[model samples]
Target: MARFRLLPDEQLARSPLRELWREFARQHSAMAGLALFLLFVVLAVLSPLLAPHDPYLQNDALLLIAPSWSEAGLVQYPFGTDDLGRDLLSRMLIGARYSFGIALITVLGALLTGLVLGSLAGMSKGLKSSALNHVLDLALTIPSLLLAIIIVAILGPGLINTIWAIMLALLPQFVHSVRNAIAEQLNLDYVIAYRLDGASNWQVLTRVILPNIWERLTVTASMALSTAILDIAALGFLGLGAQAPTAEWGAIIADSLDLIYVAPVGVALPGLLIFTCVLSVNLVGDGLRNAMKKRRDN
Candidate 1:
């Protein structure tokens, strides 16, 4: 009745993902951020069904109406109408789809490209790794937005070109992070043990090193999302990304700039949404970083 048995080694081993999630949930700010982010994602996904009017439709009679509840506003145009008389609320909902969709796509592209390049550099030695490192350093020397702008300018203004430009601008940071993580893991005792156990170089890199480095990469990816969104918006604002009638947030702001005094909300609303999205993403990244740090300490 008093005898007890020890748990199996497998059962004793903690789940890293579960542990990380526990830590993440302990952070109130991070939970709030995650909720806000999910709300926007749902809004973006449901835009077509939920939007009250055609984002691109024009009616001269309804132009420049203030948001409902404003002294001069109309209930029919809750967020008001732009100079072209397009419904601002409807345009913004659709813009969420464009803005967030492009950001997600660009981040994914950058992550894939970076993982391939970085893995190669990380696995290599001497001159080869050095050359890759040098290239990354050179790319890092330029500001990301400026580099994106230059790339967009060279490729000519359009949606696909802008996505490529943003992806290219983001690629170097991921490459650098992954490369460093792999190189550091190579010197660890577990890697040496795996090699002594007759593990192939490929196995050591893929099975041993990659799994250990995934947390770092995840953190990098989360942070890069915010950067990707900002870069996309910047390109759109400069008329190099999404074009007219597309309902992208930055394009919306750009089109409404001349009407700032006449319809300030038209400009402010998009900018606020962009700010909120970026802030939420950054908060989530910060939470992950903190969670990882705590896990390591434990």
Candidate 2:
């Protein structure tokens, strides 16, 4: 049997991803955001083992309990209880998994669909590209949240439907961004050189243009992550996503609204989680954009 060999250290140091990581690491805000995001991921992954109580189990006697240390609070329910008496900490942990998982799935679906359509649009000659652009523009005119709501309404309310709805709503933005990037690259010296060297259109696109535009795509994806999280949460808030008995962050907040005055912490905790997650993602996206700009300048 033949033995496999790893790349030499010098070659590894020159890798684009390694270079990108070095750049990303230098941005303190970006590193902080990454840390916070990773913490959420860890919490989500370990929720089953870490959460003290079953998220669904309710105790009527403990309904609307306050956080521990409050006069009426119990030590066992540190973060308090929801209206139905579900443990707030446990529900929030499980909600982290649901919210992040759904957002990631939706973004990935949109990214794949967009890349395919956008590449085709960018490479096409005349009429096909024009038609695709027109359709994408029409889709872009509507706000993504509104479009998502319309889709969810049409599809009927449910978790899977909300995912599909958000994915479709986010698709146009990715298509527009990728198509423009590819179209711009098509006229560049590198692309012309590749063509002159007898490289096929697909080869130039896959091996050259795609690599050059990857940084932009990553920034776009990060921004889309925040948007997807917010949109999914909005859908859940409206009772159109991750239906009752499921521990989704938005659903938790929505369910606690009527008791906001009575148990403000119950409503605030989940909302705080949503805000922190979205803010961190946006910060990371901004940091990436700045880093890419500096890289191009150098």
Candidate 3:
């Protein structure tokens, strides 16, 4: 009798989307968070078409008009108008693009910087290791918000400068997290075995260690993104972030402080958006962490 080998069919492969939905359902809180986040993302992306008017264009006649529900109603401005007569809803939607865009860039930059620094520090030992580790520690010790404010003050308030400020503030935390993760992986038994088997340090680190810890790294990256979004919004609220006339959530809120009594939702819309975005990101992060942890345990 001849022995036959069988190859697994492609259809047998796992479904990532199904797995994701299952995970989402498993963590209802996170799922809710993700839903809110996705909603905001959709809103941001569709702002140009969905918005009642140009976010920048103003109508003095419609300025600060109280929102009405009596007739389906009130000229398409659901959230009301700002002090500048700009549609609050329109600004919030447009602001979503800038706010989310900056946060994503800030996190990516930080993650890349951290990954490189951490990998180098973990790979090297003795004085090189100690020096690099100490630098990362010191970097983390510095207060990010204060540093961002100072940097922004010096750079002048604008979207580009705000992104740079956020990146600078966020980089240290990324460096620390990545360094710790890498260091832990470097000392694992598998790594030692790989090294003993004549694997180069680079080979052990990249091939043996990195592959094993990639899931954890992915969780960390997502969590960092959530934090970055909140931090950017906070910076904008402080007036050290994205400048005026750019539809920034934080700036919108800051600008609406005076009109809080007259047009509450003008402040509320962006405030609510910031809250939901951050909350959603955090929820998604928690879900990812839990799922990854469970997989590891299994």
* Better model by TM-score: candidate 1 vs candidate 3: 1
Better of 1 and 3 by lDDT: 1
TM-score of each: 0.94, 0.93, 0.88
Question: Clash number for every model?
Answer: 0, 0, 0
What is the lDDT, from 0 to 100, of the residue 297 in candidate 3? 60
What TM-score does structure 1 among the candidates reach? 0.94
Model 2 residue runs over 4 Å out of place are 1-13
Give the C-alpha miss distance for residue 283 in model 1, angstroms: 0.6
Q: Give the alpha carbon lDDT tens digit for every residue of 180-210 in model 3.
A: 8877987788778878899997888778877
Pick by lDDT: 2 or 3, better one? 2
RMSD of 2: 3.9
Q: Encode model 2's per-residue lDDT on 56-152: one tens digit a residue.
A: 9989898888899899899999999988888999999999888887898899999989999899989897998999999999999999999999999
Model 3 steric clash pairs: none
For each candidate, what is the lDDT? 0.89, 0.89, 0.76
Error of 1 at 65 (Å): 1.4
* Cα error of candidate 1 at position 26, Å: 0.9
Q: Of the candidates shown, which would achieve the greatest TM-score relative to the real structure?
A: 1
The residue-level lDDT of candidate 2 at 78 comes to 95
Q: What is the lDDT of candidate 3?
A: 0.76
